[model samples]
Each structure stands twice: as structure tokens, then as C-alpha cells.
Target: MNNPAPASPSPASEYGARARAWDWRRALAPTGNVGDAVFRAALFGCALLLLLIVVAMFVEIGSNARLSISRFGLPFLAGREWNPVRGEFGALPFVYGTVVSSLLALALAVPVSLGIAVFLVEQAPRALARLLAFLVELLAAIPSVVYGLWGIFVLAPFLREHVEPPLQKALGWLPFFQGTVTGIGLLTGGVILAIMVTPIVTAVVRDVLAAVPVSQREAALALGATKWETTRVVLANGAPGIAGAIILGLGRAVGETMAVTMVIGNRPEISASLFQPSYTIASVIANEFTEATGDLYLSALVELGLVLFLVTFVVNGAARLLVWSVTRGTSGVARA
Candidate 1:
């Protein structure tokens, strides 16, 4: 029967073929349009938020400038004088203090936080892990003002009495530790910042480590790896995430105001010694913004705010790129 005429190319098969070949352009056009609309909406929202922050910062500063921002121009950033009454404003010392203190905070906080996160996630029992996580989160939720107050009264005094003096005595040869123990200084501020950022890094790194697959750990163990070895490999694999978390903590430290202002001593001078008092961008803004008067003075302050915002944005963007690269590289290596 000629194989039943090839089953007459069954209608169901034809229908299926037709469905697959249907006007995809027409069918997907609406969906594509909807997706585009959503993307545009998100983009617009982000732009709006950025615009709002920028405008607010400018407005706040413009309202306080002693002279027009254009009048002082580039000198505003390089000029050392900051006399508002004289309509003079310079950001050099503040910038110096800001960057140095934040870097110090990162140096102190990152490793400690990583260690804490690794221990909590890999070594601690579930009960202990949960407890630790809760505590860290609680620390994070504490207001910045409270931390500042505590830093000034409790931490600064302790550092002045114990930590700063000992370090200065031991590392007196180093410029950073050359000065005599001052309770409120760059070192003290850095220490407080480290403490403030520790919980952030720990929480982030813990989550990152926990996200690692159980099977990967099992495979490492099956291959006769020690616990530390497995953790090292797994953590190394998650290095990008850990770095991003540290960067995030750094950003937080850099932008912190109240706590830092309280402990930083808010000195408007740059010094080689961490033991000497210093100021930061946030502290400068917090301490001076309210008191700033005159167009040029106010503009200079606004310009400082702009610099801080840009610096933060750049750092965060770089961190995201680093994380992205790490994730992409790891996935490719994993597949290979």
C-alpha cells in the first residue's frame, strides 16, 4: 500500500510545523516592545535618582557659597585656606585625610572580616553560625551616630590609652605612627571605621561563601582535601565576591559622616602621622556645610561634595567590573 502513502503527512505534523513557522515577528513584537518599555523605565528611574542627588547636593552648597564657584575655580581644590569669613576654601587637606583614613580602614577591616566570615560559614556549627550572623547584622543596624558617640567616648579613649601609644612606641620609625598618641586622630578614626565596616564585610562574605555549592565542597573532600584546603579553594573561587564586599565596606567607610566626624577630630590639616588629627570628605561636609557662607565658599564645598560622589561612584563601578570579571572567568574555567 506504499506505506499508506507516507501517512498523508499527518495534519497534526503539518499543524506543528505551521505553529513553529508562524509569524514570529508579529507574535513577539508586543513582548519585545514590553521588554523595551520596562528597560527604558528602569533606566529613567536610575537617571532620575542620580539627578535628584546631584541637584540636591548642588542646591545645598550653592545656597551657602561666599563667592561664585567659578570665581575660585581650580584653586578651590588646591588652596589650603578654608576661611569661610574670608571667602576662601580649599579641599587639599580634606581630600588627603579622606583617602588616607579610608585606605587605612580597608587595610585593617578586609582580612579580619574575611577570616570571620570563613570561620562562621565553614567552621562553626549551624547554631553558632546563625548566632554570629545575627550579631553581625545587629551591629550593622546600629545607627552611625551611636557608633560615632561610642567611638569618641569609648573607642577613642581606649586607643589613646592603649593601642595608639603602643603602636607609636613600637613603630615610631614609621611616619604614619610617628606622632604621639592622640585620642582623636586618623589612626583612631581608621580603627573606628574598621570596626564599623567589619560587620558589613562579614555578612557579605558569609553570604557569598554560603552560596558556594555543597557538591563542590564534597568533591574536594572526596579528592582527599583537608577542610582548610577545600575552604581555600572554594573561597579562592569566590575571591571576586569577597573583594566586592570589601570594596562595598570601604565605600561605606568613606561615606560615613556622624561616627567619623565624632572620632576623626575633624582637623583641617594633613599630617604624616596617623596619630595626628585629620579630616575626611564626609566629616568636612558635615562639620562645615551648615556653617559655610558666601558664594565661593559654598561652591567650593559643593565641589568637594561632587568630588566625593564621583570618587565613590568610580570605586563602586570598578568593584562591579572586578566582580563581573571574576564571575565570568570562574564560570568559563568551571566549564572547561
Candidate 2:
């Protein structure tokens, strides 16, 4: 049917115009789906890599601690004895020191950190606030070894000469405040730990408090609230995130090695007095990792490392979960 070549359907020019229109439309549209997918996959990969690294750490520690785990059984935790030569190992003393020192550090750090945070967020002039924040965070930049050195040469002497005596004279009746006023003890270690962790606590709290919506402060003040009241209300609102920050600091205190070991006297004893020498899991590992000749001794230290790792992991994990929950629940606030 050569009926005028079937009118050639449509003209080539019309087909070209249709193609050009399609091209223009596509240019105007969002068309980077493959790029978006690649970016999303990369982010997911980073998250998964962190999780896998954590799992790998647990596996490595567990595998190394197998000998001690098999040898000690449940009594390992309760037993207080530790002798490398005798191959008698118990984690009670280390556990006690770690917990007590961390608790003490927290007790000392929290109030001070909160005060600094509040001062910066609600009270200080902007310039002054920035200056103070810089100084506060500078503490975190100091090395652990330097803190240990300062603890040994400076803080220890100050406590021994001045601070410990007053506490001993006033509160020596209590078990916790008894014993010889040695500068290098649980209390001293705790103080060192407190100094080390204060930056973390303050920095976290400052950010958390700052993340609180301006409207929250305005709302509190609108209801005839005083400045202090407004601040308190804001704090209460951010309490969960604050708690997470404190827990994160506690984790830091728990895992401190050289600074604590240098000042804690490295005695594996569960004494009631803060003045008494004590040993934490980390301190023991730092002090004895090289001297651990026997397989059991090495394994015991590795097990202590495992314990410290688990404790840190659990604390940080809980803090992250709590912070996430608080951030998710809040409105118009940055993620903690």
C-alpha cells in the first residue's frame, strides 16, 4: 500500500521535538537515584563497620581470656586474692576499686560540671562563655601520662599536706575516711579521675543544655518563673540527656589506666578507707602486663581487661540508648 507512503507516520522534526521535550523534562527532574543509593549505602556501611569492630573487640578479649575463665569459674569474681607468683587471681579487689573510684569521681564531677554548664548556657556573656568553654575543654586535651605526672608530683602532695588532713581530722571516724592520709590512694585516684572526666561531663552537658529550644526557656519565664527557675526547668527537661552524659563520664573514669595506676598505689585490696591503697582492673593490667610471665597471670590480666571492656561497653551503650531516646522524644532539639 504505497498510499502516499502512509504519510510517513509523523515528521522526523516532530519526533525530534518530542525527544527534546523529554530531555528538558528529565533535566528539570531529580534524577540522581543511583548517587543517593550509593551515599546511603556508604553511611550504612560506616555504621555497620563500627558495630562489627565492637563485636570483634569482644571476641578478641574473650578468646584471650579463655584460660582464666576456665580456671577460675564463678569464684573468680568473689575471690579477693591476687598473686602473680602464686598464680592465685581474683577480680574482687579490682572490681571494688574500679566501682568505688568511678563513683567517687562522679560524685565530685557532676555538681561542678553542671554548675559550669549552667553558668555558660544561662549566665555568662557570649565572649566569656566561649572563653570558659575553651578552657574547660582544654582539660580533655591533656594526656593521661601528664595527668599521672601531675598527680604524682603536684596533686598528691597538695592532698597529703592540706586536703587529706582536714578530712581525716573531721571524718576519720567513718571507715571511708579513715587510715593514714596517703596522697596516693583510692581518694587520690578518684580525684585524678574526676579532673580527667570533668571536661567530658561539662562539654556534654553544655551541648545538651544548649540544644534545648529557646522556646523552653521563654515558656518557663512566661509563667512567672525566675531565671533560676527557668534554668531548672530546662535542666529537668534535659535530665535524661544529662544522665547519659554523666554515665559517659563514668565510663571514662572506669577505663582510666596510667593516671589511676600511677596514683592508686596498685594494691589489690578492698579497704573501707579511701586513704588505703587500691587497685583497679585497668591499673593492674597497666602495672603488670609486662611482668606477667605465667600463662595464668597473663590470662588473668586479659580477663581483667575483658571485664573493664565489658563495663565500659555496657555503660557507653546504655548512655547512647538513653541519649537517643531523649533526643527522639524531644521536639525541635538537636540529637544528643
Most lDDT-accurate candidate? 2
What C-alpha RMSD separates each model from the true structure? 8.8, 9.9
Q: Which has the greatest TM-score? A: 2
Give the TM-score (vs. native) of candidate 1. 0.77
Per-residue lDDT tens digits of candidate 1, residues 126-183?
Answer: 9998898788778888899998899989998898898877887788898888866779
Poorest stretch of ten by lDDT in candidate 2 = 24-33
lDDT of each: 0.77, 0.86
Q: In model 1, which residue pairs have backbone atoms overlapping below 3 Å?
A: 65-294, 65-295, 65-298, 66-294, 66-295, 66-296, 67-295, 67-296
* TM-score of each model, paired residue for residue: 0.77, 0.85
lDDT of candidate 2 at residue 266, scale 0 to 100: 91
lDDT of 2 by residue, 35-148 (tens): 545666677789999999989999998999999999997798899888777878989999999999999999999999999999999999999999998899899999999999
Model 2: residues >4 Å from true position, as ranges?
1-47, 328-336
Q: What lDDT would candidate 2 get against the real structure?
A: 0.86
